[model samples]
Target: MTITIQQQFSINLNALLDEAGVPASGFGRSKHVATSMDVGVATAGKWLSGKQIPEYDRLERMKEWLGCSFDDLLGRTEARGGRIPARAENVLLNMVGTRSATRISICPDEPASIRSDGVYALPIEGDVMSPYVVDGDMVCFMPAMSAHTDGVYVIHVAERYIVRRVNLTTRGTVKLIAENARYEAEEVDLAEEVKRRNGVRIVGVVCARILVNR
Candidate 1:
């Protein structure tokens, strides 16, 4: 028999709750989910009963709290031979323009250690990084306030977010290198930028890239 998405979600949620040691049926199950997701008990009950599915943000939160992927939560993917799917929260490049978060199932081959809660997925918007990380690719990163290593990172500066390979040079400056030769590398003084309130913030370090099929 074919199962609807709502039914699948209910089944998956119950299984996840059971795996987490919540009782199969009772106020405890709904209350636990409601508390964890910060929703009303009636809403949680609807989810538990297959009467409704959560919106995007709530679904993302549910997956994160349950330590599972979107596929796992929605019954899109199943474990085989003891291997679980990897997952990450999907965030947009322009945070100010859009404040939304969803979930994406990472490639199953991804290391199990990468399934941590700190991981996030950001879709590439332009060809600035090109050849290496082109437009349409989704890059996964770990949130970081400062650059501890010279590598590819997502940074917010001059009122925009950009992806670049950062190199900390002498004289309190950092060089932003674009993989594409068509673009020129730019160097900015970290202290001067901060003093000017340009807000040079290192958002995160890029750890994995999901390439788009040509």
Candidate 2:
């Protein structure tokens, strides 16, 4: 039996959600989809029910959130002989705290160490994370709702997104540390920030670094 495009999209989306460890059904599923796709819960419900598909802009957001290719999401891999097109996995590089919308393709030849589903990439643009992760390089991270002190993470604070080494202080504050010593670390009181409408959000945890060739 031939599957309709909506059916195909639903199937593909479910598969990706499964890989991400989301439940197959219920409010949890719809909520995760909504959060990941950055859409309303109703919209996510429609997509999950196969009543509608995402528009191009949302598709781009979905690609980054799910860390999959358009082919994978649109069910085009079968027509392409089961091989994902070269650099099919493209992610918009969120430079500094702004959305640049500049996409960088992940070459198929990338080492397995940095390849994984549900992983997103952010391009480093300055010396803030220097030496450990220099400018012109891209860091691959897994989308995370929370931050841990074990590693570096991309976070939203003071109305800007940045990559920093997170350290949870005993004084109920989160410290954002830059790898470059010249830059002083900043500590934020999460509760106060939220009260002031300046909230701290954990975007993702850095997993691997893709060194760009100069």
Q: In every candidate, how many clashes are there?
A: 0, 0
lDDT of each: 0.62, 0.61
lDDT digits (tens) for residues 1-214 of candidate 2: 3455775676567556644545324215677788877789888977865567999999998899889889787864366465422221332221222333334333222222333344566778787865445576666565566654435787765655578877888987888888666799989876666566547766667654543521
Clashing residue pairs, candidate 2? none
* Model 1 deviation from the true structure expressed as Cα RMSD, one decimal place: 17.7
- Give per-model TM-scores: 0.45, 0.43
Best by TM-score: 1
lDDT of model 1, residue 35? 89
For candidate 2, give the lDDT of residue 159: 58
Name the runs in model 1 displaced over 4 angstroms.
1-117
Worst 10 residues of 2 by lDDT: 86-95
Error of 2 at 197 (Å): 4.1
